[model samples]
Target: SGAVHFTRNNLSAYIRSNVRYLVALLVAGFDPSSGPELHYIDPFGSSVPIRYGGHGSGINFCTPIFEEFYKPTLDKRTAYNIIQKCVAEIQKRLVINLRNFDVFVIGREGITKLDPINQVSLRAQLMGNPPPRK
Candidate 1:
């Protein structure tokens, strides 16, 4: 919670100083005493706790997928699979192309980084399209 407040303050100060840029931040982690935490910090530095959230241009595309699929008790494999599904949906639906993504898992053990996913490749797999030629 302190971290979230600090981030909100920093963002608020930055926006106050620069007035020309808008940015939102997502802070997520695993807390030992409390389990999982996800906070969406808006451009004005207002922070809201959320179970599942997305930021920036892809939020519209990703949020619905998350809402439809997210479960608090998801296992690692299921969570990763849902992430892939979200990415695939975004690639297919969004106007701008996003090529790759880095995935991390925050859990009881701590943050675990996974192999990055190439959105094009994953989209092809999800959609039954041919893979990019090697």
Candidate 2:
């Protein structure tokens, strides 16, 4: 059976005991046949796969962005494109002092860190400007 495991933090444990509540969530697991998986855990601790997941102060404003551009069959490049576009909207419309973002890629080879997305790159893409020379 290809059941996805969705485990959440025992919230009752937090209310009864003084377990330190952390805002950030880490979702990781490996399926022998289906390969590896990662998720963004919500405050309630549900670990489910999502095409797009956001936490923090800008979620309300960010929903529209995801709604317009999200696709289920997105490859790596397309996924990053959506994320970049969302961040661009976030910076302009939302009040968060966001500057850049870090990207991490997961695959059969394991997780590999990628370059951070900065304001300059977003500006170029959003404005249709050419990429700067390496």
Candidate 3:
């Protein structure tokens, strides 16, 4: 797919030209001919297509969760649950306190934004407890 190749190449070139800047990205799309696609472009210009990937400070925490739960044919609800778990684990284990996350889905119909999930509330919900007092 030329579009996919072009996107990766363009990001690689951009990262190369802007060495001083941090430019990590997760590029996801739905190609009419190929279905869903996901790519991760790192700060060093290296890019690779992935079934599931995470970036930034919380990536290390999130990757294992994705690896354990990700399925190629997972349902939307199940996928959302995995993401919530990832955010929750990040909040719990990562030194940095990252709380809010914006979620979106790319499919045959195009991109759809889902409700933002808060790590604190999600963590409590997953634990079968109430949200922590502020």
Best by lDDT: 1
What are the models' TM-scores?
A: 0.78, 0.68, 0.77
Model 2: per-residue Cα lDDT over 18-40, one tens digit each: 67565546565555676555576
Off by over 4 Å in 3: 1-3, 11-22, 43-46, 119-124, 127-134
- 1 or 3, which is superior by TM-score? 1
Candidate 1 lDDT, 1-134, residue by residue in tens: 77898988888888778554477778988777898899988878899999988766777888888898899899876777777878777777889878888888877887888756675558566687644321
Quantify all predictions' global Cα lDDT against the true fold: 0.78, 0.64, 0.76
Task: Provide C-alpha RMSD values for all models, in order.
Answer: 4.5, 4.2, 4.7
By lDDT: ranked, best first? 1, 3, 2
Q: What lDDT score goes with residue 55 in model 2? A: 72
The digit string of per-residue lDDT tens for model 3 on 6-124 reads 76677667666744556778778888887898987776657778999876778898888889999899977678778888887877788876668887888987787776679556857
Clashes of each: 0, 0, 0
Tell how far residue 26 is off in model 3, in angstroms. Answer: 1.8
Determine which window of 10 residues in candidate 1 has minimal summed lDDT. 125-134
| Clashing pairs in model 3, backbone N/Cα/C closer than 3 A | none
